[model samples]
Target: MKMEFDLRMTQEQKLIMTQQMQMSVKILQMTNMEMQSYITKEIEENPILETEKKSKEKKDDIDYKELIKYLDDDFNYSNKNYYVNNEEEVSPFTFISAKKSLKEYLIEQVIDLNLSESLKYLCMYIVEDIDSRGYLYTNKNILAEELNVEISTVEEALKVIHSLDPPGIGGVNLIECLKIQLNKKQITDKEIYLIVENYLQSMADNKYAVIAKELNISIQEAQRYGDIIKTLEPKPSRGFYTGEETNYISPEAHIKKINDEYFVIMNNDEIPKLNINKTYKNIIYNDEDEKTVKYVKDKINSALFLIKSINQRESTIFRILTKLVEVQRDYFDMGEKYLKPLTLKELAEMLQIHESTVSRAIRDKYVYTDKGTIKIKDLFITGIAQNNYDDNVSTLIIKKEIKNIVESEDSKKPYSDQKICDLLKEKNFNISRRTVAKYREELEIKSSSKRKRY
Candidate 1:
């Protein structure tokens, strides 16, 4: 046996994701708002990058004939009557009432409180730390350490926060929050407070008899106490706006039906158009210093690459949406009942792109259709085969059917999972009792026993 080192050469192909490629992938996966922010940041950093400006004069110029021609050829605008006057066009910037956020509301209340600067700052810190659910889950000791203050001082600030507007805003947990609200209401009943503090779980489970026996009260009295507890707001910030504001989704593309033919319209209105800055371009072109020219050249290249990547992202999204519309034509024409089962892998194979690419393209993207504005990901659903095996039906459709059946069932004798399965089978859905139960659970529907009314 000879122990010898052997050297061999082998040829293999592999993909190495470059920095530019990674950036492109990131840009592809970004939502519209994220992409806008990213682009704005890029423009701020790189002087060579600028957003293309459309002047009001340029926009209002009388060129209806050319516009109509372009729309017909590029956008497939068939109906002439569909063309609307500019006056009738709805402005995207319609009136929206701005609501003060929970943090803002708390801060305003804290400011009015006459306290030392240190205490005020600490109170604000505690208020800021309160979560969207209007609860301060952060440990007082940890907060003290982070704020570089005494634990006693932090505790005082927390006490102040608990006393602020929107009762139960600074509680540590659900039970504590309820207790805080009860305290604010000056609830004198010790039994009610004890029930909230100790037997919240029992109350939640509707163990009224247990609560009655434990509290030495009748079941009806327990029920009355339960009703009082129910009146207390679980979520203190329920009506108040949290930090997470409602983001209005702008569709990337639209599937419009024109003259019995569906046309895919890419939405470019919302997305900012990028163009190389003419001033920077000229400076780079005429600069004598090699270093300066090189610096400008690098920035120019980066800006160009970013523009190209954005274009690629838009085109990819458009293609995916077009393919989706084509496959789910029945769904578009009708409703959820006609939606077919689809998978990312199947779509990737059909589009000749990687499954991850398909996922990235559809991530946070939306499409406006004759039906409604729908999330791109919602269009692709795992399906189950029908009894006839003619076509696959989306699990969403199955859920919808299950919901309908449950909705129409006799309340006194609600359908069981097995009965629901049988009913679905009669409707050509090949599903088991377990599958029916799973679907019911997903729909948040209770079991037949729970749903049944005596």
Candidate 2:
């Protein structure tokens, strides 16, 4: 048992810090809204870094909303505002929308209230904890413990805070909020309270008979109360304070229909116009203090890196989208049904880039079009079995078929998960029973036993 120690580099290697990898992972995980805030913060913190905003920006240029509308299945189809606004009215055009935040509104009300500084601070903390639904998610006990104050003081602060505008704003949950609203409106119906507090779960599950039995009321009565609950605002934060805006990806390509041809315009117009900070460059040239020069150099290098990274991200997105448009041209020209089959590997090989790069470019990314916005990721698909008829099928098409089958099945004799698998296999899908069940669950459909009417 002899120990020989020999250190030799089999290959030149560099050790990467965990923090650097963590930062990259964090950036990758950030939603478009969160990324915007991050970039804005970076701009503020880094002196040399700046955003480039283009002049004469077109209203429909970015096409983020358009892309989302396309991707979201539940988007209102009948909303005329969703389509291009065709009205030709000469109304005064406001350059900027003056929207006030929920936090700011609360602070304004707090100013009129003669509360001490400490109480105000506590109220601010409470207000911050209130989610978009206007429900206070944090417990009063926790707040009291954290502040080293009695629970009574926290309750008192909550009482004052709840009285602010937007009634039922500071409740800990939906039931409490509704109770507050009901009390304020002077509705002394015990049935309403029961429905709000206890029967909500039953109503959600559409178990009318169970709710009626539990409450010792008629099914019709239970349904009426359920209707009332439906009318209540679940999300109290709708159009409230912006608080922390999520980082959103602005679209890089705008696809437009011109005559018979589709036009693809890169929407890189909105990115903040960036340049090297002249002041920093001057400091570097003037032999400023060694530390100052180093600091300026670091800032300049950071700005360059950021600018380069942004450009690369844009280019990667553009290349992926360009290829997507080429492949799915029929979809852009005609409709969704005409969408062609594409894969990350196919794009990666064609573009001479990694499949991961293609995946990242499409991850939470979208493209704006005359029809609407389409998520970049939806362009790829795993094809289903093709029969002797030569009709190509995609997984999306298979999922749609499964949905139709379930939807049209008899309620008394709903198709079992096994039956679905059999039916799909008969149609040459070559899918397993487990796969069918998985797809069914993803569609939020109930099992045959659960879906049975009798």
Candidate 3:
């Protein structure tokens, strides 16, 4: 081997992620509330940036929608009354009021029941011991021993606790939870009680034949009663305030049809519309201290870049969504069932950009459509070969079909994965058995063995 060293000129072109490009990418991905918060922080840190005041003048009876640029000098998206038809929507906090928590509600009911002092104190102790899942975390025997009372007395308190609102609030276990709710519903069927007590595991395993042998019923009847059990709530605390905060969705854009034309509409009510401060602009030009002038200029450039990046984000989102309305026209016109096969790569190519650019443009962004407010990325669906006619099927549609098939199949003779594949093929879907199994799993449908009745 020989050691060699030489100075040579090399030439190769490569892509580089610049600061401005990074900001553009970041702004594109932020949700509406996120963008608003980001702009507010930027305004606070940069003296050159200030939020432009919205005009208070009224424009009456406009009653129309149009697609337009967001950052133009004539931007009027802030006129909520004119564009949104006085929808008068407010922030989620506006709807927030003091709510009574589950434990608090339970304690209040126990107090109002006017029970004897001993029973009241016992009920209060049990209510305080209940967890957020509505389960009595402490054992009844343990509580009885602690209170120096009999187990029957604790059970009597438990019966009173279980009789409160939200039917299953004080159940000690899942089985007890189901029984409490079923009791409240007045379902006196012996078959349901047996299934709840002795055949729960068998029911879960779809051993309806074993259940039928024990219950003296047909397989069909077992299946029917099992179906009823599935509807019961396992978590009694559902739909109640549990001290957990909820994250609300605020859509970034509205896709509306105006006179048979689709438009990307945005609102600036919460978003800060930024502009350079005239005082800072004057200081930059006249300040004697070079350091001060330099600082002002740097801040001004930063503010301008931020504003430009935000504008670019709005425009890019508008163009992509406008094109989406064209590419996924069937989806918008029909529903989710017609959402065609599309990928970020394919959409990037169609828009003459990189895949990462499309990915960033849709990241965390929400769009309001006729169907519902949905994440923008959900519009891009993976495509599958639908049939001989070359039609494409969305994986969403495939999952939907799998769910429908499972729901409609005979419970006593459930179809296997292969049988489900054959059924899809009969309906012009060309997926394999494994693919069927995958989609079935995604739909949370169990195997044929587990789905079958006795």
User: Candidate 2 on 1-454: residue-level lDDT in tens?
Assistant: 9999999878777977665344544554333445566677778888866544422434334342333332212222222111121222211111213457887788788777999988888888898888767788899999999889999999989988877777778889888887777766677879889888777777777687788888898877877777777776665566665565443345545665568765555554333545544445556667749888777766665555554455555556666666777888887777766766677898899999988777766677666676656676788976665656565677777788899899899977999989998888788777878888888887899888656553
| Residue-pair clashes, model 2 | 20
Q: List the RMSD of every prediction in angstroms.
A: 8.1, 11.6, 7.6
What TM-score, computed on C-alpha atoms, does each candidate reach? 0.69, 0.65, 0.68
Question: Quick one: best lDDT, which candidate?
Answer: 1
Worst 10 residues of 3 by lDDT: 62-71
In terms of lDDT, model 2 sits at 0.68
| lDDT over C-alpha atoms for residue 146 of model 3 | 90
Where does candidate 3 clash, by residue pair?
Answer: 208-454, 209-454
Residues 1-454, candidate 3: write the lDDT tens digits: 9999999999999999988677877787887778888998887788767766632322222121221121123233331221321233422223335556898889899999978989999999998889878889899989988999999999999999989988888888998899998999999998898899888998888888889988899988998899999998888887667766345467666777778877666644567777666565456446799888777766766776686677767767777887888998888888898888999998889989888878887887777777767888889989889788667888998889888888999977999999999999999998999998888887788899887654
Candidate 1, after superposition: displacement of residue 219 in Å? 6.3
lDDT of each: 0.79, 0.68, 0.78
Model 3 regions more than 4 Å off: 1-4, 12-23, 36-165, 170-183, 186-203, 207-226, 240-247, 275-302, 335-338, 390-404
- For model 1, residues 1-454, the per-residue Cα lDDT tens digits are 9899999999999999999889999999987767878888998998877676832233234343342331212222123212111321222222223567999999999999999988999898888788889999798989989978889999888889988889888998999899988888888898899899889888776677889998999877887788899899889988778877557576666677778777676665556777666555455557798888777767767776787788778777877877888998988888877777889999999989999999998888876666667888988889788987887778998999999999999977999999999999999999889999998998999888656543
Residue pairs with colliding backbones in model 1 are none
Ranking by lDDT: 1, 3, 2
Selected candidate, larger lDDT, 1 vs 2:
1
How far off is residue 437 in model 1, in Å?
Answer: 3.8
